[model samples]
Target: MLFKFRRHWETPWEVVDSKAVKPVYMYYDDEDSLDIVAVSDADTRGTYVFEVNHLTRTALRNAVTFSRQQLIHQVAKKGFNVLVLESWRLTIFRRGKSHRVEVMYSGRPAEALGKLPHLPPPPFMDVLHEFM
Candidate 1:
């Protein structure tokens, strides 16, 4: 019998905070996995964390795949957080702000793209409903 071992990728946490919304910590793995942790209280006692796998990532990417103009319009019309993750970078948009982070895989650095032009409805809505 043969056994296969998978490599583990660790992403350092990046935190974003604002007076209007809860603080959010975002990070990604080498396999295109995204982890989002939202802190609900000032004391960081209550929290909600979402871990998205490759399948969910694919669905999200497909759902938001739109022309630049279309994306800008959709984002302006709907207020929701959007995340785009590629092999080398992770981009996030929330509350009209955008940010990009470089991703390193197996200790190799990768290039990052600019902020996406548009926003799509949150792809994790269904998963969120399950917990509520």
Candidate 2:
């Protein structure tokens, strides 16, 4: 899916390929900013931090239809710790202090992560069951 970024002091929007890297932490601030820290290179533990303005923030907010804390709570209710969105799949991870396990939901490449717009609908029990 396409992710748009409006950087601070920049009027034009910057488009990015969300699937290029796996995002580990994502937050939307009250100042109309969206902060995302992704694992750019797992081998080096490198990260890419993107701080974008209101437009991008609104796009993401509309996509998820929920607040950051709500999303985390929803995922926690299912016993998952991390959520990764790829071009072709949604991968949910269960992490421990040292190790992590994952479960993937395939198809729906166009759908944004956290926004499960498929049949048999929301509260994604099928996907959540994988975590258990």
Candidate 3:
């Protein structure tokens, strides 16, 4: 824990809400670069913040996909395939006309020992090359 640039599922904030529920940052690696040794689940604090309560103006991307599909079905029944540091948040309350919707989903659960290598693409994507 000496250095980190940000890769807790890498989500700064960008939910246009066309049916929001977008979070599953593929595979994470902020310089960890595919070392493959993940077995993180330190005594059950692996991280998870599920909260989906709806009833606002109706239609909230299906309550954020029913709270991210019940947090990926309880993290794949606790066996975990891969779910690194994902993040999500969206809250609203009015009360004047009965409005209250929340969709908070966090993540951090891993058990990857195989098949997870495919993440090299960041370095600004080579400045998005396009010289034509």
Candidate 4:
């Protein structure tokens, strides 16, 4: 039946509830420093906005993990555009108290590693489809 077929092919984007999910962020600064902050209700719940340092191996790995989790939740393992995935980034505030927003997801593991200068891609990409 058409209903069954549609259900079979549907890709579920699992968006976390703003109230229940506690989003977290790990930022890297230029001096090999890592700063992590959890996104609370006072801040944007599901959005990451800041200029965290992306130039460390661990930082890059963490960023990939963060994005992968969200993407898996959103796309439900139906597969994603590699090009699109490689183009995503997590943006954040720089040197001001201002809370302006931006996106820095490059979807590419290589790009993330580049920021660190010496690192491999996160390990989670290997099992991205298992959850779907």
Error of 3 at 105 (Å): 3.7
Best-fitting candidate, measured by lDDT? 3
Give the winner by TM-score: 1 or 4: 4
Model 4 lDDT tens row, 1-132: 455444655554332111111232222345352222222222211234433444333443455557555643443233321121223333333333223223333332111222323323433343323212
lDDT of 1 at 89: 15
Task: Give the TM-score of each candidate.
Answer: 0.17, 0.18, 0.27, 0.26
Could you give candidate 1's per-residue lDDT for residues 21-97 as a string of tens digits?
A: 12222234452333333311211111112233332344323332322224333433433223332111122222223
TM-score of 3: 0.27
Ranking by TM-score: 3, 4, 2, 1
Clashing pairs in 2: none
After superposition on all C-alphas, the RMSD of every candidate to the true structure, in Å, is 20.5, 20.1, 17.3, 18.2
Off by over 4 Å in 3: 1-21, 24-73, 84-91, 97-101, 104-110, 114-132
What lDDT does each candidate get? Answer: 0.28, 0.28, 0.47, 0.33
Candidate 3 lDDT by residue in tens digits, 40-110: 55322222222324443324445544655576567768786555655555554443334445566656666
When 3 and 4 are scored with TM-score, the better candidate is 3
lDDT of 3 at 118: 53
TM-score of model 4 (CA atoms): 0.26
The true-structure Cα RMSD of candidate 1 reads 20.5
